[model samples]
Target: MTSTAIPSAPRRSTFAQPIMAGLVTALVGYTSSFAVVLTGLRAVGATDAQAASGLFALTIALAICAVGLAWFTKRPITTAWSTPGAALLAGAAAVNFGWNEAVGAFIMTGVLIAATGAIPWLGRTLAAIPVPLAQAMLAGVLLKLCLAPFVALSTIPLHVAPVIVVWLLFLRFSPRWAVPAAMAAALGIAGFSMGRADAAGVMGQLLPSLEFTAPAFSLAAFTAITLPLFVVTMASQNVPGVAVLASFNYETPWRASMLATGLGSSAAAFLGGHAINLAAISAALAAGDEAGEDRSRRWIAAVSSGGFYILLGLASAAITALATASPEGLLEAAAGLALLATLGSSASSALSDPSSRMSSLVAFLIAGSGLSFAGIGGAFWALVAGLTLRLLIERKRH
Candidate 1:
């Protein structure tokens, strides 16, 4: 009898490289977007405690979804609270609804998102949004945040310059680490500038706590906030997120992913979070070769990122405190640096198709205008204008 040697599985790197990749991915994602989340919460009348709880809830829910989905799908599917949705919430606050009503709106938005997965036509319609228009809307939504660094330089040059310098210098060698380095520098400068007593006060009570805001559904919320939030989350966040995965040739389980995001958002909304959806920029970090040389092992990067997210969620109080302790524009600067690549990519994608150029520009400009009408943000209107213009333009050609 001839003995045949069994094939061994590919050996994963025993070094901390994969873990580092995950850690960086998690840190970047959390730091880059957490500031916006906080601002949105505060805008919607959340007390500091409530805002902290929202961050904690969102992070934990997304962490669980990321870990579970990545493990099940064998793909790197990073989940996040919708950044644009948060921005919309911030703007929607102008309508002066109480936080409870906002939570109700969040619940409604999550239901709509979940319904898309359960309802075929709805999902197809959402999925069918023209890529250029969606990309344009996202670019518009990001423009404000991406301009933070410039704003910071103007407002707090002394603090921001060194951070920017560090980022630029590091970008030449370690592109991934540049943003994190800048963030660390910002935090360091902020801490020192704040004085020891203030810094200590900021670090007070480092524990995870849940704060529930009961839902108060209203027709106004449904039309003004919920619908727009759902649309932006779908078009600007989840759709682009899924596209990133597909671009890398990952056959994602779209239905399952959407269902998971909707459930996570619903659960987190009760605990003060707004929405949780697929991550676009950070997903690329975890799914690509940067995660690992071997595609099969990249899931570990996402799992590690999820674990770190949970830990960060547990320390939400400290995180919020630190963010609050920073100089007014410092967090924005750091976040802008983190989003620079994403904004550039989205802009390029939006204008790449010559046929969609005019319509895409219209969407981009409107969304970037930061206008709000009837509690709906520029993003929604931008989409509407873009679609209308595209229709009119294309009809003439035909």
Candidate 2:
């Protein structure tokens, strides 16, 4: 036997790890805050079908944006709907503008986002907005939603207790899955409680469908919805998303990312979607070490995540149906649980700097108060009050 030289075994492909990470990213991103999104859309006047359309549109839009950006830049650039923006909408004081005008506001927001990247001065102006105040506004916007779980506990103890218990258990054991687990429990309870008639109705409309609304603009919508939404999305999502990727040594193509998200948001808005931007929290799943050790191939994780998002988008109708059918406050409780961490982080950051403490507190209170005046929402007033207070304080110090 002529010294038989056996071929070495083939190296196992490493693609599976990153792909799995991408799947996790999509799952966590979708499950954690989707109730908030639906709630926000409904609050802003979207009908059930419309809200489902919005959710589906947002999921598909961001998924496409994430996949394209990752492939084009060869980087793990993920995208997400602005969870903070949704909270802002959910918390907004009742406005004069209806859903069409809100859609118009969404369009305007997208325009502003695009302009921020395309116009250097505009970007700087947005960047110049005090970080503490922005964070305060965010904390305020998140306050009510974060309190829902506690409020629900008092009202529906028997039904809500199990969901809260599940959340707490997972929170202590596997923190990352806590909110998602709570949402699953809430959905399970909701499904169990559904009468046969309700079940039949839901089964008939399980597939997602799109509903288009022609945009209508107004000063009230601009001031109350568009401006605040733009700031929240930019401040909370896009900027932090860039920072997260940077922490992983990945350089995001800023202008391109903004343009992509801006355009995507505008498109999704037509379908009643609020807004889409870069992924901040979920970006880590696709960009960080969890994706893989091969830095160069990490983009595949983002691409895979986009694929999963597309699949999730298909179930928007069913998810929305289940969420809407839940016992009053149950879904809100789940949404609140999802937002607690964010509320804590935002509150901590807003109060961190002593010099800005008073101003930040003012902003937080004003935003959380649900105040509306002359057709403008509390969010706009919160920023104004906070900035004015800051200016006065600075002038006094000087």
Which candidate gets the maximum lDDT versus the true structure?
2
lDDT of 1: 0.82
Off by over 4 Å in 1: 1-21, 87-93, 195-197, 247-249, 288-298
Who wins the TM-score comparison?
2
lDDT string for model 2 (1-398, tens) is: 57988999987649998899999999999999999999898888999999999999999999999999999999999999999999999986487779999999999999998888799999999999998899999999899889998998899887889999999999999998998899899999999988887788778878899999999999999998888899889988999999999999999999999999999999999999989999999999999989988898899999999999999999999989887777898888889889998899899999999889999999999999988999898999999999999998854875
* Tens-digit per-residue lDDT, 82-101, candidate 1: 88777666555556468888
Would you list the clashing residue pairs of candidate 1? none
lDDT: worst 10-residue window of model 2: 389-398
Worst 10 residues of 1 by lDDT: 88-97
What lDDT does candidate 1 reach at residue 226?
79
What does candidate 1 score in Cα RMSD to the true structure?
Answer: 3.9
Error at 124, model 1, angstroms: 1.1
Candidate 2 C-alpha error for residue 18, in Å: 1.0
